[model samples]
Target: MNADAVPGLVAVLAVTVTTIAIGTWGLRFSRTTSDFFVASRTVNPRLNASAIGGEYLSAASFLGVAGLLLVGGAEMLWYPVGWTAGYLVLLVLVAAPLRRSGAYTLPDFAEARLGSTVVRSACSLLVVGVGWLYLLPQFQGAGLTLESAIGAPRWVGPLIVGVVVLVNVMSGGMRSITFVQAFQYWLKLTALLVPAMVLLVVWLDDGRPGSPSGSDGAWSVPVAGEGAIGLYTTYSLIIALFLGTMGLPHVVVRFYTNPDGRAARRTTLVVLGLLGLFYVWPPVFAALGRVYGRELVAEGHADVLVLELPRLMMSGLGGELLTGLVTAGAFAAFLSTASGLAIAVSGVITQDVTSRFVGERGPTASVAAAFRLAAVIAVSVPVLVALLSTNIGVARSVALAFAVAASTFCPLLMLGIWWRRLTDAGALAGLAAGGLGAGGAAVLNLVGVEGSGWGAALLAQPAAWSMPLAFATMVLVSLATPSRAPSHARRFLVRLHTPEVLEQAG
Candidate 1:
């Protein structure tokens, strides 16, 4: 290995070992499926918040944010701002009620709320779809990180990340991950924070570099272009990031770890704080990259700017050490997020798919056996997709996943939680409308499909239209099929809204 490769390679290995060690420590507590699935609902707010931040950061937040700002200009700030704000929406609308529902996965919530196996199955499929869509970038981002940091073959990174996540997840499940992810959150924050501070010092020491646009009045605005489509794209992206957080399978599952509805809300508030603080660092990297790392933007390697910025500004051991630190954090970002998604996907598959064949054996047997089987499927599908396709910018790929979530589950959760009249027919209709409309556009965009004029903008960013359409379809269909409403809808809503303390007293 070259001299520069040593620190990065060592960093990756160290993080992998640390993650597995933390996960193994959690195995002692995971004595039951309930523990594996939800940490026995005992995770405290602070720890739970940290784990949520770790899992939610993903490659997009860690690598993609700075990269987007580096190349896409200030308009991309919405991605981070909206991502942080998404939890606020969750806090006010869904967090507490969702925790009180006692559902393990989104499908469980559907069945518990809608009282329909059909709606449950539809939710299960969408969970897997969204989970897989989200996982695609974590794996792809892993490849890009490794190839950039150590000059490894593009395929090598995904394989390593996949195997590591598989072992950590199947070893102890959610119980294990709560500790592992919490630790990763701090690790990621420090990794980004330290380098940013030092880089800012160096830039100031060299006399502040002007914005890369060279005083052309660029970097002054947060939105790109003033054309009709540009305006549409900005609003559409904002919609996706703002609404999508509540819908992410991995993110929603974290709430299930909180002990009660109140704890869930508190955890979300803490998560908002943590996310807000971490986001502050990425823009620093973007600004530094604009000044010193322009070559990467020109060559389409902007995603590695955070990893490379250390070396660009500081020479010798200082640069190498910082690179190693950032590299460890980047790897941790993938591990934490991938582990969370794998668990989310596995839980859904175990409950909805694998249980059918083995459920007669009971929750103990089915949860154990089915969970193991599901983990394999959860990690495998996305790894294959990452390998088969070309690399898109990590943040943009994540944005696509956000658009799908915003389009589908955002409507489902908002309407399902707030609206009493939601029916299985309506839920299914909305899921189909949102999933196909946004998901089709995602697939087309991924495969290099394009269109001229407004069609391209809509396809490239579908949430603006798709989310509203989903909301409308669900409402209209529910009204049309009032007879298909769950007979227990009001009681379920009551269950969701009631405080855990009050419910327990009764």
Candidate 2:
């Protein structure tokens, strides 16, 4: 190993050890099934918000955004903006209502609202699909981080991070990870913030330098694309990022841990602030990269800018220490986010697949056992895929996950919460339409399909079209089959929309 790699390797080891230690500490609280699933639905807004920030700011936010900005320029700002604004959309529309649904998972909400096993099963499949899709990038990112930090083989990072996350999830489930994630959020923020502050001081100490000469003029443009194609791509991305948060199985699952709808709303409010604060630093790193690390952009290694910038700007002990700090944060990003996704997917699998064999009224021990088994299965598939699949831009891959979520669950959630006339038939139809559209596009992209013109643009960003198609299909199908609507729809809506105070008084 290179001498310089020692700090990074030490940082990775420290983070891994600390994560396991924290998870084991949390195991003391993870006795019952409820404790395993949703922290017994008692996480306060502040703590829950911090945990949300930890998991939600995945590899995409930590590394991909700055890299994209370094190469793609100001237009990439939309990624962070849309990501943070997503919580805003959730706060206003979905958070409180979703919490009030009294469902443990998205599939639970689907079944409760639509009163159909078929709808619930379809939702379960989608939750797993989206979870795995999102987890893919997290795993891939782990490999990239390890490769950049310590010259470890790329496969080493994914396997190590995956195993660490699995151990935590299997040990205590959501309750265990809640503490771990909450701690990681602050660590990630500090990891990025301190280095950024020091770099800014260094830049000021030197002159604030301009972009390197002969840079592409397009790099300065804030818009991602030009003309109609640019506008379409930008809007499609915005649609996905803004609406997709409510549909992300991991993100939505966090809401279930809140004590009530009111607390869920409060949690989202705090999350918005926390996310906004965290996002401010990535762009700073991108701008600094333009000055100090422009060669990384040319080398197509911009993803490592956050990890590399600290060492480049300073040398000796300080640089190595900062490198180690950011490396720790990057590993935390993979672990925390992967842990959340595992919990969400495992909950669905335990409920839908494992528990069926055990019977619905099985002992709590049986249920927890099923959850642990499902956690292993939930994480294993993604690790294998990350090992075999071709690497893509982490942020772009995550955006596709968002698009899929936007196209499928976003419609299901919005109408399911606000529209009483929605029926199982409508939900199923909308899911198929949106899922096939966006998912097909994603698959094609994954297989290295490429093209130009509007066809390529549409495939690259399907949300603008697919999301509307889903909403329209759901509405039209429901209107056509009013008799198929759930008899309990109105009652569920009442529960969802009613303030907790009113429900308590009643």
User: Model 2 residue 27 lDDT?
Assistant: 94
Local accuracy of candidate 2 as per-residue lDDT tens digits, 205-317: 87765743323554334345678888888899999999988899999999999999999999999998999899989989988888888899778899999999988888899
Residue-level lDDT for 2 in candidate 2: 99
Clashing pairs in 1: 75-222
- Across residues 1-506, which tens digit of lDDT does each residue of candidate 1 receive? 88998889999999999998999988888889898799889999999999999999999999999988888777678889889989999999999999988899899998888888998888889889889988999999999889988999989888999999999888889999899999999999999999999888888788864853322334434354768877888889889999998999999999998999999999999999999999999988988888898899888889999999999999999999999999999999999999999999999998877766665566666678788889999999999999999987788788888999998899999988889999999999999999999999989988989898888889988999999999999999999999988888888889889997886799
Please, what's the RMSD in Å of model 1?
1.8
Best by lDDT: 2
Q: For each candidate, what is the lDDT?
A: 0.90, 0.92
Q: Total clashing residue pairs per candidate?
A: 1, 0
TM-score of each: 0.97, 0.97
How high a TM-score does candidate 2 get? 0.97
Off by over 4 Å in 2: 211-223, 357-362
